[model samples]
Target: MTTLDPYLAARIHLLSGLDWDGIADPEARSRFDEYGRDPGEWTMPDVDVVDHAAPGPHGDVTVRVYTPPAPAAGALLWVHGGGFWGGDLDMPESSVVAAELASRAGIVVASVGYRLAVDGVRYPVPLDDVVAAWEWFVRERPAASPVCLGGASAGGALALAAAIRLRDAGSLLPAGLFLAYPVVHFPVPALDDATAAAMRSLPPLLRFPPSLIEEMFANYVGRLGDLPPLATPGHAPLGGLPAVHLVSCELDDLRPSADLLARQLAEAGVEVRAQLAAGMPHGHLNRTPTLDGVDRSLAHFAAGLRALNGAGEVPPDVA
Candidate 1:
């Protein structure tokens, strides 16, 4: 079996002995706050970043757009993941990924700041914000440019649901989809024996057990039963969607969910190109881009973006 990346394994090893569930809230927050601090250096390629307000049903949704100096290969509407409640435009998964994709793939990226599932906000609220941002981005971009939709973790669920919505509504659809370690299932499918064994070595904080999965969904949709299909899109019909590039992390509990969705997509006749990020954990994109795994994941997504516009491949330097 492949081992965890040494850097990540060392980090996880430090927390392996901690009783994550037993820790007091305040203490746990204090101990883990360092993980969220911005990396001191930001040595990414030069790109023009701007934020714009896109009209949504509830209010204006903010979209951070990144533009490359060169002509763009295509446009991507990107979403960040936080279990549907925690991420923002400033997170590395949002800003760093957008900047890298724009500069490396020569693509314009619109990172959506969707409403989180908190303070009574629930299903369809975050989805609506994403849809609104997508429509606005589509209208703003050149008609000839190919546009793709992408997200990581919960954001993947939103991106796929939005794609399905656009298809059913007879609206313009994206040219492709780029999903990274997406948690698209309700129960989050059971892991295979190999994956289960691999997960045993991870810290409690790194794991997503069944109970945690249920709690996350409960917080997301209020009630799990009689839910809208889009709430857990893995069960929804995935036919007629555009080409998909799915990245499943090797050691993630949610890897099974991504695997299930890949099968569903293929059975539904969608073109799917899936890769397992070896020796990686879920949300590795949240790490500093200097990490080898993070750069590899970014390159995989950038290559997919370039392919969406028939741009051949990512440049060697970018790759």
Candidate 2:
């Protein structure tokens, strides 16, 4: 058996005792707040964040815009990675990602807060919010300029789904797509295996059951068999889609699905690039200090954006 990494084990131990179900909405928000409360400290010298609220189909969706040091020629609409049930607009890990992307790409980065599954908002609701946020950015934030869409995990899935919806409806396509270890399919064969094992080896809270995945999907999708290509982007067509960069972790359950989509995109003649992060876990990007995978991932995204926006040249660090 593989020995659990010590840091991962410690994280698991901390999470195990926490009662996620019993926590009130305000408490959960407080916990999320604790993770990334100080945006000023979180911001790098090259990064500046603008907090804005835009109208959505449901209501106003909040977006945190990240501006890099250089002139902003284009923008990336970033979605945070929470398995649909949890996560907020200002989580530290995501904030760090937004800052890094803005700094590296010299582009405007808009981190979005779509409706979460926990508050009766589910599937298409999140998708609607994503689209609404994208449209709002294009209409309101002229400084953001030419736009692209991207996200991690569930956010990644939503990014692709939103792009597809936009393309199908004849909306302007983003310059490119960026996804990091995205969770694309529900009732997957076994995504939580490594995550579950990580929990068992580390402590207790870190170890979650595969069953919970089912519960989350059911709640979001409203039924077991009601799956649509939009919800599971792997099953969707890719012809005429914008250039895409999909990053997946070696130990992540979403690896296989990402692989399948990569193959499909290639077969359809779409410009697509996918990187598999060896030895990383499902949410590895969030733990940036613990993992260097996102470094390479963001550098690649920077290069891609530069190329897409005619922003001059790709950075030397990108492979």
Candidate 3:
């Protein structure tokens, strides 16, 4: 029996006490209406928020732009995560993540509202929305606004896939990648027997069955063969990709995917930095209130963006 970390254990207890897991999307949205209200919230005296809309495959996608207290030298193109089925642009966790990145990285943060798969749009739909958002950022913002794309889980997968697409299209590559527990495989591979068994025995955050994962993948892929490599960066050739900063939690079922991608990227000669937050579970980056690991992850994310922008060496404290 693997025990949850003390902080994480308490968090699990708290989440179980809530109605978040079973509520309808609309009802859940109403309950957690504002960003930075839950775990991602940290005190950042210097931060600004603005609402922006960009043209996407699905009409206009709303984006919440986070401006750092300092003058921004660049912008971060951020995608929010919800298993490709849930999440909105202004969700509390996403907002806190964006604001943390903006404040710590000293850059502007554009939180993307990509189309959800279950809500109508499917796999490539999210990718199209990401690309459109990127286009809008480059077209509407300063040419010098170096853009780095990042996201958590599904959003992270989209960032990698989008980067691959941009690279193939001969488009300007983002300065770097900030992937937090990204889903790399399109039909996300099944959890190994050990991982699957462990997950079944763990707390809610640490438990994700292989069967459920298969369902998610099937839903997203939808009987498509030769799905674009841009839909799953792990399948794409790594050559010519930007430097990557990937964060993975040890208790996450997707840690294997992150580890494999990191090894592959490094072997292919991409500048890669992989950090493993031991004992933390999937989406730990969203639990800023209880986990020291979340704060470190955000700080590292900011530092990685800064490094790509020629802002100096990554601060040693960020690990």
Candidate 4:
């Protein structure tokens, strides 16, 4: 049996008994806040990090740019995941991944700070922000620079949706896509027998049941009925898109969705490479990069970005 990493198992044990459904609860929030506190040991490499305002229909969207010291191999427009309700550019999944990719892959990384699905905000708003930021980034970068689009969780949904919009508009499509444990299916696919059995041991906070997944989508689009394909691109047509590099967490409830997407991509004649992060749970990228699994996940993304620039092979450290 594939076991949970000891470090993550211990952390999950500490977070046990807290109701993930009550994330808005003061106690739940407090516990999560404490758990999310990061040590200051992790440092960014020698790279220029800057924040810029990209014009958006709703307002100015924040796009954090990370530039490597040497010439960039390519560029990536990254999106962070929070089930459509939470997450920001400051999250480790966003900022740290951008910094690591910028240094490790020798590429420019633009992390988008799209509006969350809260208050009266609904579908197409966050998508608009990402699209706007992508357009701005494309204009700002060199004409010949190869650019890719990537995201994790809900951010992955947005990234794929944005790509669909670009493709439909006959606009420039990304050279490739890097999706990390993406939640692209609205209903979220059902897990297989072995995977389902494995998920039974996960902490409540780490499990994404079907009901919870549905509720998350409802909150994002304002209703579950007649959902937009772009909002959950797994069921949408997936032809003519660029090559994809997808990471699926072994212990994640959302792995089924990512697996289905891989098959769909193949059926649609799109080149795709999917790798499972063994012994890892969903949102592993949110953890400190010092962890072996986190570093490997980042390296997978770095290798994908490097491939876009015609780099020969995956680096020795990726596995």
Candidate 5:
């Protein structure tokens, strides 16, 4: 049996009352708020942060722009993750990721708050909000810099969906794609024996059953038959998308699909870099603030952005 890593076990224990059902429970938001919240002091780096709202398909959407110390030459549009039902710009996930990438990666980082599924918004609407933020960033913030798109979990999936929408709409393609353990399919398949066993070893709140995960998918994509390629990037054609950098958590249930994305991208002759963080669980980007694995993952994410964004070199270090 694969021994459960104590680092992941401890983090999982801290996340109580978080499950598929808890997302809709009266206390669901509170639990999600607590689970996704960052607990440490967040000091602003030597950069400028602008918080403002832009027009969206449904309503106004909030976005934060992080200007690096140096002149902005590259830009990354980052989407937050919440299983499609939860997460926001004010969450610790957004604040920490934006600061780390902007200061370390040396590129302007625009963290977007696309509407959530919990607010009665669905697939394309959330995706529309992301594109809206990207448009606003291009027009108002950093138009001259080379651009890349990235997201975490559902946000990652949305990033891909937005890219496809842009492609169909004849918008310019992004230089690269960086996804952190993204949810690519509506009904993510069941885990195999080894992965399922590894997941069971974790705490209850961390182990998501296939049924519960499907429910979350239902909340995002209303009709199963309407599952288009844009809804699930794994099943979509990879010809026109930018080079991909997919960083998946080792113990994450989404690892299988992420692997499929890498394989599909590669088979389609697209440049791809796929890395799995050893012994780490999904959402490590949000959960582990100071661990070496988290640092490495963030650094890799930045590296992908830098490769596409030009020479703004920053080495990986523990934060």
Candidate 6:
């Protein structure tokens, strides 16, 4: 049996103990932000950062650009995940990951602070933010060179959706996609018997009740019937998606959706790679400071970025 990382368990427990019902409250949101664990950072390296607000449909999206030492391998526009309700660019996943990818992969990392669904923010608002941020990056950087797109959880779904949208518009498609436990299946479905049984057996910190997801979906997509394949991507056609690198958490209630997406992408003849964080919880990459699982996921992300940059090949390594 795989042992759960104690740090992750404690973090999950802490989050679970919070008055989650108050998450939509401003003060409660602040408390949740403060209570979050320290997002890990990469070892120090020469990196130049420029943070600014770019034009968007609703307002402006904040974007942070990280430039690392020497020649650049390629560029990536990374989005942060927080269930479409919360999260920011300063979080470890965005800040630290960008720094690390720039240093380790020699890629320019543009971390986006897209409009979050909380504070009365809505779906298309967040999606609009990502589109604006990406457009700005492509315009500012090399339009000839391909840019990879990446995100975790909510951000991941947006990344894929945006890529598809771009394809439809005959715009430049994302060179690749990095999705970490993405919430693609909007209008979250009821967990099947087997998955439900497995989730029930998980620790309180790890167990994801269907009610929680239902609330998130309601808060995100106000009208279930209005959900298009672009908004709720689980059922979206995977034919045109770029090579995908999807990471799933073993204990996540969202695994089934990820698995479905992976299989569908493969069936569509898209190059797909999937990895699971063994004994990890949902949002495992951000739940702990730096665990073995986090390292493993990051390594896969780095390798994928290199391949997207045409620097190497990512062989079939899904499990």
The C-alpha TM-scores of every prediction are 0.92, 0.80, 0.85, 0.93, 0.86, 0.86
Clashing pairs in 1: none
lDDT for predicted candidate 2 compared with the true structure: 0.71
| The candidate that achieves the highest TM-score relative to the unseen native structure | 4
Lowest-scoring 10 consecutive residues by lDDT in candidate 4? 310-319
Can you tell me which runs of candidate 3 are displaced by over 4 Å? Answer: 1-3, 10-41, 186-200, 224-226, 315-319
Q: What tens digits encode model 2's per-residue C-alpha lDDT throughout 11-99?
A: 33333334556445676546533542221233354777789897987999988988877646788899987777778866644787788
On lDDT, the leading prediction is: 4
- Candidate 5 yields a Cα-based lDDT of 0.75
lDDT of 3 by residue, 168-191 (tens): 899988888889988887455556
| lDDT for each residue of candidate 5 in 1-319, tens digit (9 for 90 to 100) | 4444455445454456466545677676665555444445446667789887978777888889888877458888899898888888876567778878888778888899888887576777888899998887777744556888889988888898888788878997777888888889756766678877778766556665677677777888786676877778777777778888778877877777777777778888887777777777777777544666677888787776775656644333221
* Higher-scoring candidate on TM-score, 2 or 3: 3
State the local distance difference test value for candidate 6.
0.77
Candidate 1: tens digits of C-alpha lDDT, residues 199-239 = 88787877888888898899999998987899988988899
* Model 2 clashing residue pairs (backbone): 9-202, 16-205, 199-207
Any residue pairs clashing in model 3, and if so which?
35-92
Whichever of 3 and 4 has more TM-score, that candidate is 4
**C-alpha lDDT score of every prediction, in listed order:** 0.86, 0.71, 0.74, 0.86, 0.75, 0.77
Clashes of each: 0, 3, 1, 0, 0, 0
Clashing pairs in 5: none
Per-residue error (Å), model 2, residue 48 = 2.1
The model with the greater lDDT, 5 or 6, is 6
lDDT of 1 at 128: 97
